[model samples]
Target: MKKTAVKKTASRRPRARLKKSPLPFVDPAGQNGLNPEPPRAIFLEQPAVYPGTAPKAPGFELPPDYGDTKIALFAKDPWWLYAYWEVAEPDKAREAIRGLGLAVQRTVLRVYELATDSRAAERVSFFDILVGSTTGDWFIDVGQPDKCWMTELGFVADNGRFFALVGSEAVRTPRFGVSDVVDEEWSFSSELFWKIYRASGRIGAGASSYDVRAVVIESWQESAALQKKQLLLKGEGPSSFQSRGSA
Candidate 1:
């Protein structure tokens, strides 16, 4: 008997298993699964202290603020004066320049010499300086001393017109000669020197005191000699002793 051919279907190919990407490891917050809240920032307010008052604790001090646009004038010497300024608001300065209706070429400092008589009109002098958004201190030779001076910082236009931005308070330049009065009542009194000499003589009557005074004088002389030698070595020229000896 011919048996029907057994039908053997091809074994089905095994299905491919898709591999998933591993998740990143995250640190667990606490024993509980909930995340902990972030810490809040704390700020302690400090009380303001006045100038002469003693503070409970030493605190940081801030520098003085002279407002948006400030100019100051200081006497450097009999002939020179120093001027410094600050521009706090650049936008305001730019707006002022725009209002001038002239192209600014550079920054100009106008120094006005007020009349000593106060009745005469102020004499104006100008100095041109190339400055940027910020400027440092500047020195100007104001010539004569013992005169009142004031300064104005401004922008000089290409058309030679100046737009004054800020002005400084008037300051007096010191005279070249002795401007301060000498206290001759105490300094030139012969009786006071005589009393001091008598007291020193009584105190230095002991041999020990004499020896100490001699030692102090010798030490002072030696230090003076060393300082003179150092100055000479630094190219300050010959000392009086050297000059005399050479002569």
Candidate 2:
């Protein structure tokens, strides 16, 4: 009897996976008090904006659907106005900010577009670096930060220990658009957001509170001598020495 060889057949259909969008209603520690993660901007709701509240984008900026239910924030510093939408269906809330590459801007942050990916962590790093540099200073020049972080960068604490931290998190939308190709007409509907901040900079990561505080204060100032000026203070007004001269 002759032996016959059997052949294997492949299926016509491909593997199916869930189409997941970045978390909908994301509130980084900066503003929206909900999520309270780091990179959260200082968001304070202004008085009833009423009819003149947030302006509408001709095509996508201000959609009529946004409704008056929304109030203007960052009145004094209306920089990053995070937008969110809630769908009563399966009880889901989404951040409609990323779907549209509507271009984020701030008065002082006009120097650079931050033209790369921006999520919570980068924001955290940006803030961390900012606060860590501006301690006790007025104005500072800011720039778009590079996140490829390598070479073991860190801060030196009073104890003479070099403190370094490594952070990781989901990437922000648009900048990468890894999920989908960016379309011109941007809206909150397809917006995608993620948690971002200095991951390992906290106490749990071996960094001291003093170092963290120093970084935070210095971050507010963005100058060339940022760290040098902030970290190394003048030193208690030049330690005076009271000694009698030898005769």
Candidate 3:
């Protein structure tokens, strides 16, 4: 019969749970709390500035009309002329019609071909182009080169008479071929002429110097023969005189 000693244990109690914060916790070194690594950045070279840098150009816009009543003609090429015109306000047109005492029926562009450069010279020929009311520009096909031309913007009256509003200065179209002003005649030596001919590929690149010499000799002989033939045809040849002397 022995008495046993028993140990008493304390009752278990539930612990209180802590609420989570919505904001992220930051470290004193200004780094993310979850990822404690420092932030990284890439550096780039600074740009250079030049002393001759130009300022930005201002925006430019062309007005529809210059508010002046004028017609200008320009020669685009040997056979074409461009004409542009601007009519003043409607009141100006009415005033012009009243001053001329004519009722305008339609607009017209009259093209004139001057015979000479003299201001008092008459027009050799003229043609009319029927341009509508809304036309501001036109391309005229002159079909002739090296000619002086003039144009007038006008209106055909109801009575079939024409009234001019504005006239452009006469412009001369250029010729397509070589200029007529010849200062002097250019003559080249036979050796120089042959060199140019060879350079121009008339003589083949694969030809030897002897071949070039033969070609030049043949060309000279042919030219002399041609000159003799021409003299014989004209009845004034050395061959005819030699034959007469032989006879």
- Across 50-85, the per-residue lDDT of candidate 3 in tens digits comes to 778757579997787777888889999999999999
How well does candidate 3 match the true structure in TM-score terms? 0.51
Better of 2 and 3 by lDDT: 3
lDDT of 2 at 108: 15
Q: What is the C-alpha lDDT of each candidate?
A: 0.69, 0.31, 0.80
Q: Model 3 segments beyond 4 Å from truth? A: 1-61, 99-101, 118-120, 179-181, 185-193, 200-247
Q: What is the lDDT of residue 36 in candidate 1?
A: 57
Candidate 2's residue-wise lDDT over 41-130, tens digit each? 787887666786776767745433422222111111112212122112211111222223222121111111223343222333333222
Q: Is candidate 1 or candidate 2 better by TM-score?
A: 1
RMSD of each: 26.5, 36.7, 19.9
Residue-level lDDT of model 1, residues 1-247, one tens digit each, is: 9899999999999999999988644447455555656789998799877888964677887655445588889888889899888766555665777787756777767788886524144665444555543345688887888888888777777788777788888887888987487764224345444444554665455345565566556556766787788878876756656877789
Error of 2 at 144 (Å): 6.2
